[model samples]
Target chain A: MYQTNQYEGMIAETVSMRGHNGDVINAYVARPLGAGPFPGMVVIHHAPGWDEWYRECARRFAHHGYVSISPNLYFRDGHGTPEDVGAKVRAAGGAPDARVLGDLDGANAWLRSLPYVSRKVGIFGTCSGGRQAFLAGCRLKGLDAVIECWGGRVVQSKEELTPNQPVAPIDYTKDLSCPIIGIFGNEDKSPTPEQVNAHEAELKKHGKQYEFHRYEGAGHGFFYYDRPAYRQEQAVDGWKKVLAFTEKTLR
Target chain B: MCTMIAHQVRIQGRGKSGPEWFEVHEANVSYDHPYDLPLEHALNIDFVNETLGPGARVAVELSVDAARQLVKTIEAVLAQADQRGVLEDRPVAAEPARSPSVA
Candidate 1:
């Protein structure tokens, strides 16, 4: 396994890349500064926006010996505060699935193109991003691991379909090509416990390799430390599980 | 939960951006996670001008109860103003040329 000491150097910055349909978008990239190969991750930002938390997530991945990049999914809306961009995207009916998939494809490709990175790549996201990560694993090629953190609407009904989200991600479980891990809050109403069960059942029917960890006292976005629903115990445990899963699969 | 449900409508108003004011062309309202509020979820309202980018926005996140109270207060104020002839400017006669020019 790759190891790094506290004294090791790291680089984090905002970079640009071609996204879906050749649109240029900004992304936050962070990785160790050494000249060795390291596992990489695509840190998908939550629906709240590509804000400080997402930047911290990229840095955290680098601290754990992984190159990480988080593409600004709302960049097409033009530059501004995360909340403002998020509101604009929400007003436009949220980011389209095709665009997100294309952006993730670009991010994954960019990580692999780095000289110090290995071929192994994993993807993870929070809230709606979780769903995007899972979708990336299903649609994209060359991913080693997939992690979904309380992504809602993965198993949506027909009524839930909109111009933005036309189909459910769960519908693509049969095509999932990588080892996957899902962390969910049992109390989250968006993807209720029942939806998680249905998703698990679908995965099982497809005979896909997957594991799910649900927290008892947590609800949606339990990992958001600054929010009221944060459960420290659950978030810590979930983090440990996610690291272990990625290490085993991506490394 | 990232409740992706949001309602947007065209509006005409003005909002402060930096030291100046700009025309606000739209408003979006939703019940979802607030960016700055401590609450897990609240009724978020954003007044903005898309052409000015996301920075040209005025946002508010209000608790459910507080939002309801605000609606009630607005209705009460409007009713009182109508009774006091505060809304005497008839819309049919208020043409573009008849209104005071805005610089």
Candidate 2:
């Protein structure tokens, strides 16, 4: 059981564990104000780390009756500011696939061990977080559902920030054990229509339960209302779709 | 100086022998930004009619630079389409995967 923070109504706690490469991992857990175990959701942050936006996202999930955990994927080096972490990520040529998959597994185990979390858990993310969600559904086990929004598909040999590689979701569609949904902007250059179409074809071939939403005239980051790329109508509609998907699958 | 302008172009007309109707739409134009400008400024009634439809609505928001670039791109595409006689003015059907209930 975890205790609430000084803010009140927000269940906040911390845990220290080991990640994929045996690096020490630190994570934050947030739950609803009420009692009883709730549905678990592993919320992966974008590449930089656990910023305020990421924490608020976890709180939002908690508000909706889920035990949300946001893990620090870059905890190996240290808990630095977002800018510092961004620099490190750039210096390291971005995160490697092996390390990311391992950290996701570690986060999953941590969520499962939480006393207030139910056995059925899901994963959700956006941008880099979305990529992690896809990896979790593909490489991890026992996930009930997964939601990925605007995740970049890097096509390169060494995991450089934006190398050309097969779309992540498409490449791993056959290995997914749970239903996965992806949202993209038609104008997002990172994952072009060709890439999205390939992913859809792969899902169709495997007969997997999946969904892909492409908003015409909307560019990357359309769901982020705070950003210049935000499209309010599209973002609202996307949120409705996400909530409905969660309620149908997570419930 | 850089300026951002938002515009709406409603095209109402009959499609060959079809019924007459008006399509309400909005476009955001930005200057100096290369990518979004072209897409935004290229957004005239015909472009909207071709991309959206004679009866459909569209909303576009972009920076000033992007608006100019958008107009240029749209004009280029339109010019080419005109020469080829493949300027499709019909509304495009929304892809199935974009639907919320798609399973």
lDDT of 1 by residue, A68-157 (tens): 999999988776678778878877778999999999999988988999999899999998999999888899998899999988889888
- Candidate 1, residues B1-103, lDDT tens digits: the string is 3677788988777766466666777888888878877776788888887766677788898999999999999989989999998875453332121111111
Indicate which candidate wins on DockQ.
1
For each prediction in turn, the share of the native Cα contacts (below 8 Å between chains A and B) that it retains comes to: 0.75, 0.00
Candidate 1: C-alpha lDDT: 0.86
lDDT of 2 by residue, A1-251 (tens): 23565333667777786678777788777887765477888888765346677777788888777888887876654334553443234323346667777877877777788776777788998866776687678878889999888765522123333331223445677798999888888987645667667767877899989988889878766765555678888888887787778877887
* Candidate 2 Cα misplacement greater than 4 A, ranges: A1-8, A154-169, B1-103
| Deviation from truth (RMSD, Å), model 1 | 3.9
Weakest 10 consecutive residues, lDDT, candidate 1 chain A? A1-10
lDDT score at residue A66, model 1, on the 0-100 scale: 93
How high is each candidate's TM-score? 0.91, 0.64
Candidate 1: which docking quality band?
medium
